[model samples]
Target: MDRHNVELNRERPLATPTDLASDAVRDIGAGLNGLLADVFALYLKTKNFHWHMSGPHFRDYHLLLDEHGSQIFEMTDEIAERGRKLGATSLRSIGHISRLQRILDNDSDFVSPEDMLSELRDDNKQLVAILRQLHEMTSSYNDHATTSVIENWIDEAERRSWFLFEMTRRSL
Candidate 1:
């Protein structure tokens, strides 16, 4: 490897100052970055289950996972762009995502259909709580732009959770 630009990273400040204090921008951006990473992880896991899912309800389960995964993936771009708008360089790679992500990754081992639905439901529920926490932080810092974006994300996440939970109640 060339091993160049090493010093650039060390010297790069988190974000350019805006209406919000530099500290506040950095803080809010960091929170968004973490949220973005978790959402990305969750999206991947949801897709994985979608692909690997088996059993009598395969079509319904697959479609549900696919839809939810798309929603989660959609959130990542907005979150990352918001971070960039704040001048923060968001996540750079999958390794970075993994480092900041809150969602757990599942291996290839077989999981029962119900187990998959339950796991995703719980994960989405956890994600909603995280979004609320970030929203509060953004509110406290008067980062209304971030807060506004978070509200929509929370709604999407909650919807995903609702769908997952509903999947659990009706069929095996």
Candidate 2:
């Protein structure tokens, strides 16, 4: 291929045709990629807590975290694919995810079970908020498909947060 063609190919790899305008593609792709990064971060953190879980509630908390981790991990592929379907490039590396992720990692040597549950609950709440924002943005751009998926994600995140909240509740 000629240099100009090569440059064009380099700019857009695996591009998919979409009705959305370039601005819509860029904006929605950015939102989806950032959401994907947060989902991956949350997934790893959930797994970390699950692996490190201990105490009288070990079995319950461990199982819960494992389930949550799986759910969070499941969102990554859909988010990335949605971005690609919008004719934009998806996240290409760990560094890209790290740069875009809003969710903070828990790197403590040890975190108490209660602290782990509480932290995860808060993170899920934050994820729900992010999903809501993305839903609004996508809807405004007339991207009904993306907004529809975000609605489901928002529900899932809220459910996870509710579960964590109940687990961490202290009877008085």
Candidate 3:
């Protein structure tokens, strides 16, 4: 079924219980939606960079972007599922994702490999910050499942950021 159909047929109060209050689940789901949007945006940007990447490091940059894009895309499903598990309707469409996303898009015809790497690194760092903020929220709510997922996400985002930093680094 489509998102609209799913929206019209949502399971209220959640089928499963985790002891979290309904309000808490709703609040956490809202936050996860934002993360979902950001992850989607970053995924697209990473794929765009993968497609447009060119220069001396063409092969290496292309492969790196592809890998990072895959990782980012992977998060979208988990984030959305988490929201659903929390008794939320979750994301509706690309428009919905676009509305919640914070990552700045680059529509330039050509962005240098280094710039692509740098932009993605910054975006990933922003995601890490978002995850950390959500981590605090989850902790407060005693949402250990959400906290566990966010911790893994933070590690992945940090790794992505670290890789980008290393690739763009210039020794003195």
User: By lDDT, who's the top model here?
Assistant: 2
* Shift in Å, residue 39, candidate 2: 0.4
lDDT of 2 by residue, 49-114 (tens): 999999999999999899999999989889998898888888999999899999999999999999
The number of the candidate with the highest TM-score is 2
The true-structure Cα RMSD of candidate 3 reads 5.1
* Pairwise TM-score winner, candidates 2 and 3: 2
Instruction: Provide the lDDT at 1 for model 1.
Output: 21
Q: For candidate 3, which ten residues in a row score worst on lDDT?
A: 8-17
On a 0 to 100 scale, what is the lDDT of residue 98 in model 1?
89
lDDT of 3 by residue, 6-78 (tens): 6645744344445789888878988999998889889999999999888888998899889888888988889
lDDT of 1 by residue, 55-81 (tens): 999998899888888888888888988
